[model samples]
Target: MTQRSITVLPGDGIGPSIVAAAIKILDAAGCQFQYDYADAGLSALEKYGELLPQTTLDLIAKNKVALKGPLTTPIGGGFTSINVTLRKHFNLYANLRPVVSFAGTQSRFENIDIITIRENTEGMYSGAGQTRALDNSSAEAMSIITHEGAERISEFAYQLAVKEGRKKVTIVHKANILKSTSGLFLEVAREVALRYPQIETNEMIVDAVCMNLVMYPERFDIIVTTNLFGDIISDLCAGLIGGLGMAPGANIGKEVAIFEAVHGSAPDIAGQNIANPCSVILAAIQLLEHLNMQDQAELIRAAIKKTLAQGKTITQDLSGSASTTEFTDAIIANL
Candidate 1:
């Protein structure tokens, strides 16, 4: 395979260490890629006086593929969310978060596998039309969902289901109440569902879906929903398997794709060396799959499974006492 260039964002907190572990495992898996490092989040703010510098954006555009660690976005004030900004900037329409059960974890469920396909750039979660009242008593935000956005995301979901041989695609929404926005989404998604007769389609209200997810998770295969719901549901699915430390997300657009650990920057454990690196490692697997390096992706995945199944040299999050580097070393050794 020809060497590919990938932009690497080390992010903040434990992001740097986990990202380093992921890169080492990738190399061990025999992936031929050149990495171009850039800074974002708090690290960039401290060094460049901005959360996201133009130079970083330029590098991401040039590479068209990025492996990002969890970035810290300051709450309140004038700072916009770096993750949201990147998604909208790149028009990354699909947020693919997949969680699967790994042996030797402390999770209750076993043989769990689910993927949440989130509409990345629209709806209530986009922070569009946000405003505050003069009296400081009330505030409001607008949720705008276009027919094009809904249709495309629905199409993307079914296409992925077909490709992966997934049995069903659940169209999750709350069309009963938020009729205007959610109703439009349901309408368009149902239209898309009719086009894919080979794949089973199930529609459930957002609230009910949440309850069913916890009670009967196996009934779900691929969950497709709007921005806010997807963000919440993906994390819930992660909990079923283990936790956010085991989840991986991929934001994909026509020209560019960014894979990342779908968890927050753990500033509390920034340099403890005990933070779990599986999230970023799984994210690298997604990146490899995106680049069509399936053999290498599966190789790394199998190694991770073996390491976790052995119930040894795993991180604290997975109920083991190994540090991030030790956990990484175990995976590399398995590879």
Candidate 2:
């Protein structure tokens, strides 16, 4: 992990603003990296007439690591989700989203630290859906759940828990209805759970998990589920600690991994200087950890915590009056 080379995609809207802030913070902390710039979202569409260009993917493949900002996916389906396409292209079958209660943040609960590990390459998001009936009638989507996919994600969840000192692993599934797909995922998950007997394990129906997630979000430690379920639950969990404004996600493959903020690109507030930069800064922390730069990662995390706890300079979304630059400066000053 010496002077890692990483692909950087400063996407559309507030993406560039926050990404620049994070890069400055990282540089100040002496994190060395050769950044290969690329494009993938609406910016790519406007610049290259394509949403996801080959050159962008090539850069990421060459570097095998990326720090991506939020991208705007057009409505009415101009392109498949750039995020999904990148995951499928790289076989990034594990989506890791850690939702923890941050100090001085707007949260309904406390002592909330949870990681949502989603099987990224399979389940309903496998992109295996088809539309039949020429009369505009029927459509079908396939949910693939193989033994390998389920076992790998489950094991990844357990291993992460062990490394991160988590105590419980919750397997959320929809096996009550999706007997084949969800059932296979759960069955394989159980097998994987057996390997880590020291870690407590539990199974909950997807619907039930959602209800409990609201009532007692602090009870969950590590939540591992299939693609669609994981996608939904990850956001739900994010809501407990405030919102996506404080959330960061990682898409991990065997050889490559990408870290990004789970929040959306706010088109209305693109260049307003009011957009929050905490999420992107937090995502950069994850990228630092990916490169085994744990000291640098911890430094940024501590700075964020200190800045938030001080409550001196904060963003609008966090119930403060500070602009994005002011908030970012506060974080750097804390460091």
- Please name the candidate that would achieve the greatest lDDT relative to the true structure: 1
lDDT of 1 by residue, 1-335 (tens): 66899999999999999999999999888897899999999999999999999999999999999999989988887677899899999999999999999988889988899999999999986765354444768677779899999999999999999999999999999999999999999999999999999999999999999899999999999999999999999989999988988999999999989999989899988999999999999999999999889999999999999999998898888889999999999999999
The residue pairs that clash in candidate 1, if any, are none
Q: What's the true lDDT of residue 15 in model 1?
A: 96
Query: Could you tell me how far off, in angstroms, the CA of residue 120 lies in candidate 2 after the best superposition?
Result: 0.9
Candidate with maximal TM-score? 1
lDDT of 2 by residue, 1-335 (tens): 76778899999889999888888899878898778899989999999999999999999999999989888878655356778888999999999998888889877787788899989988887854332335677667677899999999999999998998889999999898999989999999999999999999999999999999999887799999999999899899888887777888999999989988888888888898988788888889988888789999999999999998998788878888898899989998888
Q: lDDT of candidate 2 vs native? A: 0.88
Worst 10 residues of 2 by lDDT: 127-136
User: What is the C-alpha local distance difference test score of each model?
Assistant: 0.93, 0.88
